[model samples]
Target: MPSSFCYKVLVCFLLTYSVQYMGFGRVELNAQEGYIFENPYQKTEKQTDVTSFTIYFNQKSSQIPKSDEVRLQSVADFLNQNRNYEIYIEAHAVDGKNYKEDILISEKRSLEVERFLLIHFVEEGQIRRLFYGNSKSPNRTKAHAALNRRVEIRLQQKN
Candidate 1:
């Protein structure tokens, strides 16, 4: 009888382990019932839209250079043509030990870009701003820092 109980326990353990590690199924929560189990390998539709632009900045400066103004103008033209899209602006700074100052500078960069977009007649509600202070940089080298100090503009279709 004891041997039979041990065999049952071992079988249960193996089944549970196989279901989890082998991705046999996944447990999900629902509004009606407390829980439900579904197939782990179910297929779902994925829609991807890759459209964005990057505007570079000089070291410790949030000013938009004259050369890059044309790029911003192009972006403004695109926005003017596509009224159904919204812009997402992300400003990043080089990795400096001064976290507070870096954050302020990044914020200023984003604001400057947003101001330019506004001046070009992009709707205020259509532009969103985000700032990252040296936190997202992959490398700490001077070149990489220069690359990191830039603003990214992403255009997304309005839902």
Candidate 2:
């Protein structure tokens, strides 16, 4: 009887491990420490849990740069499938506008991202955090500033 009980326990453990390996979990969208926008578009033949994708932006560019259209589409697609997932749009900007005071460009960048998502019909409440006015990292350069100006999306874990 003891040996039979041990066999049952071993079987249960193996089954649980198999389920976990088979992508039987929810995907979590997470933001990296600094670069928030990770690969917003990842194609998976089999469904697996992805934490989330991050979308980076530019601070100096007065308008949305030309490169983001495709990524935006990816985000839209993801939301369509995962409507229950919550999002956080973090906006950031360079500290100085004209070598003087802070212009709060980060706020503008974040808002723009929100607007884009809104245009696609992602409801406002699904977005939990509309963080703004994040300072530009000192390591960023003028040419690379746009990379810093972005809104990131992260999934809120369920309670």
Q: Pick the candidate with the highest TM-score.
A: 1
lDDT of each: 0.78, 0.58
In model 1, which residue pairs have backbone atoms overlapping below 3 Å?
Answer: none
Candidate 1 global CA lDDT score: 0.78
Reference-based TM-score, model 2: 0.51
lDDT of 2 by residue, 1-159 (tens): 999999999999999999888875767987433232334573313213234544555335434544455455566667757777666766555655552333456556666767777898877767655544435453467776655556565666434
Q: Local error of candidate 1 at 110, Å? A: 0.4
Q: What is the lDDT of residue 36 in candidate 2?
A: 25
Worst 10 residues of 2 by lDDT: 42-51
Alpha-carbon runs more than 4 Å astray in model 2:
1-59, 98-103, 132-147, 157-159
Task: In angstroms, give how far residue 56 of model 2 lies from its true place.
Answer: 4.7
**CA lDDT, candidate 1, residue 11:** 100
TM-score of 1: 0.64
Q: After superposition, how far is residue 47 of candidate 2 from its true place, in Å?
A: 16
What TM-score, over all chains together, does every model reach?
0.64, 0.51
